[model samples]
Target: MLGPASVQDLGRVGQYRFGVGTSGAMDDIALRAGNILLGNDENAAGVEIAFAPFKLRFNADAAFALTGADGGAELNGRLLPPWWRACAHAGDILVLKAMSRGARSYLTVAGGIDVPLVLGSRSTQLRGEFGGFHGRALQPGDILPCDRSESPDDAGELGAEPADIALRQRTLASGARRIRVIIAGEYDRYDEAARQLFWHTDWRVTPQSNRYGYRLEGPPVQPIVPIEKRSHGIVPGVIQIPPNGQPIIQLRDAQTSGGYPKFATVVEADLWRIGQAGLGSRLRFEPISHQEALAAQAEVSVYLERLRASVRLQGEL
Candidate 1:
């Protein structure tokens, strides 16, 4: 049978036209751990479960791991935890439940998910609806074929967590409780109180958050006086404050330009956290020196080393 991170039904997602992207690991940190457990590459394509559990009947017995965002996974009525990699017997049912800690979870199989690599990756960009599982969510009766490539047989349960990332990107740094920002264009448009509120107040992640941007709902932190300035190119992590004063942080899939006035930007290292935070996650920003931001990146490199250490690669059978 096949394994995790293996993009099944390659070119299937791209053919569907599901807005241009298909689903991969919502939290890649979790997925990479699963791959390492299976002795596979981090890009190994698997079904990225969002808000629901994952269920797949293997054509053959294989080894796999479930990492991150506990959704009450059970194998033939036996409950399990995240960061677990074990061998599932043929016909044994592996079931994942709704989220308990994180919003999404990753399932990696041995030998990797054996989908034809399109454009060098099997990640389903569901927005583009290209690549991975017919460019859509895993559907029932979808027969995922296994690759002939054999994986190591590591008999154990262990892995590192996604929150373990030590890097504080220049683009997305946070302090567990507070988000940070780097002032950008249109910063001068706001008055003193507006600036204070923008930097010093707590905000709520609105239901409108997505890959395109994070819409933070908080007190109005807009310009006390209006300014007529042309729109400029927008980048991921830029906080675009409109007349309403609420800020929207753009993400990887965000558009290139916008007309709204932007005040600040989220640092780089911590940007991935936004994906992990989900729609209802409470958020607030903090200000940091540029040197601190770079230092955070160094910290991130260390954390990654620790995570790599925890990976239990499968032994040669």
Candidate 2:
């Protein structure tokens, strides 16, 4: 979602507002990390992919960073660092090719890209047709004007920038409950098999996954139980199981309210990891205690703050 391009949201950081479409990153943490690297606004324009590699050409010299899926990003055949800001010369061709780690990758540029704001948000809301470049994906030849009005000095140095994630990186974790879920809506309607299968089995991501939700392939996740609750608000990470037993894992651009029952939700911290899980990437759920989940969330926050601080200090040099 693109906002007025005024860099206002960067200054107004309190009070989480909810629109027709929810605000926040599908992988909020990773996006923040990218912003820190570029020393740009946290809502800067970057490429978001659903396990598909994105290729773009830079028309000018600028700093950029890729902070999400380890989707191999290369500049003119040379690998670029993930989660570190660097300069891209004029006419540089940046490629975010597919990686097996996660699904989406966010590429932030220095000075941030200027985009129009809609409905008090700057995120892409495909369903509502409000934010982003004309509320749609970037097409070849699309020009994303930059905010020439820049941030103060020390805005772009957030870390020891890198050039790449090592090739052949392995699974994110070995735990079964690493993919935590929270039940929502008609969860009780599904049969025991459906819930057990959903919780215990390994599912493959379909090529059809996109910003809305990841469509998985496995036992159709039916409401193991029958429907009883009314439709309510849903957020990214809530897994909504339809009547056929197929689960739709919500993402950033999901609808405001859904009638479908969500058997679980991926933890906010680990959601980005799941996004990097490319198509055909296998997934297994690992349930964790609420306290443990909270602890992990706290840890991620501290880590992010530390990353920001490190970058801030580096900028001083």
Candidate 3:
């Protein structure tokens, strides 16, 4: 079941120069976690549901997992836990209520969505309108075909594990979301004061924000003098300071190249915070060295490894 204003396959990666964005799940960790719990490939195509209430009915017995923002998921009127895997019987209904904490949630079925891959991925590039469940958000009465090899029976009476056997990712607190960044490209060209402001000021994600980029509201950050530049390659994490001074944090669906003055890039590991954050979400940036950035990423990898271990242990129990 697809719900909300922004639902897409996380997005096709590696085809950016062709003007395609890596539009996969905004919170990839959540997507990966759901896949892992259901014993699917981490990159398997799954539903990236934004803030919307939706319902899905199982045509057959299936094993599924919910991860990412706590969406108040209910299966046939019973509340389900986040970041855990469970099985649903034929005729069972799953409903996702409006989210209270995170902006997006991921739902992965046991065999994955089984959507045809476009450009080597099942991600839906909404702008281009290709890939994933007929290349758009699911509508009422639309049926999703699943790979049947891993049905609940095949997995043996499936259900969520005990809390000790399940590993959950860090939860975002209500209010300002703290984000870490690394100063990138043309950092010195900006005046000392402008650079300081970038780090010191608390920014607000405007309502205009979306998968493309987050348009921020804060003090204007201008450089010492106008610098000439040409459009060059850009990535999801690159923070571009436009003429208005408010920085736009490029996200998964951002264009491949931009000419704006590069300010700071959010490190890879912390990008999920932005992904989970909704409009009006508060943001504060803290600078860290290159070494520290790598360490943080490694820590995230360790967390995923631990989650896998926990799942294996549950099987034994």
1 or 2, greater by TM-score:
2
Query: After superposition on all CA atoms, what RMSD does each candidate show versus the true structure?
Result: 6.1, 5.1, 3.5
Q: Model 2: residues >4 Å from true position, as ranges? A: 1-19, 51-53, 151-177, 185-194, 220-225
Report the C-alpha lDDT of model 3 over 1-317, residue by residue, as the tens digit. 11243334556777866877777877887787787787788887777777668788999988888888778999999998766688888999999987866787788888888878889788776667887776676677878888877654645433333221232334345446668889988889898899889887778888888777899999999988876689888888889998888899998777888899998899988888888778777888888899999988887787888777877776778
What 10-residue stretch in candidate 3 is worst by lDDT?
159-168
**What 10-residue stretch in candidate 2 is worst by lDDT?**
3-12
Query: Model 1 — which ten-residue stretch has the worst lDDT?
Result: 1-10
Candidate 2 lDDT, 82-197, residue by residue in tens: 56566677898988776534555666777666777666566666665656677666666678776656744334423432212321224446422246655544556667777778
TM values, all candidates = 0.77, 0.80, 0.90
TM-score for candidate 2, please give it. Answer: 0.80
**Which segments of candidate 1 are over 4 A away from where they belong?**
1-25, 145-148, 161-176, 224-235, 312-317
Better of 1 and 2 by lDDT: 1
lDDT of each: 0.63, 0.62, 0.77
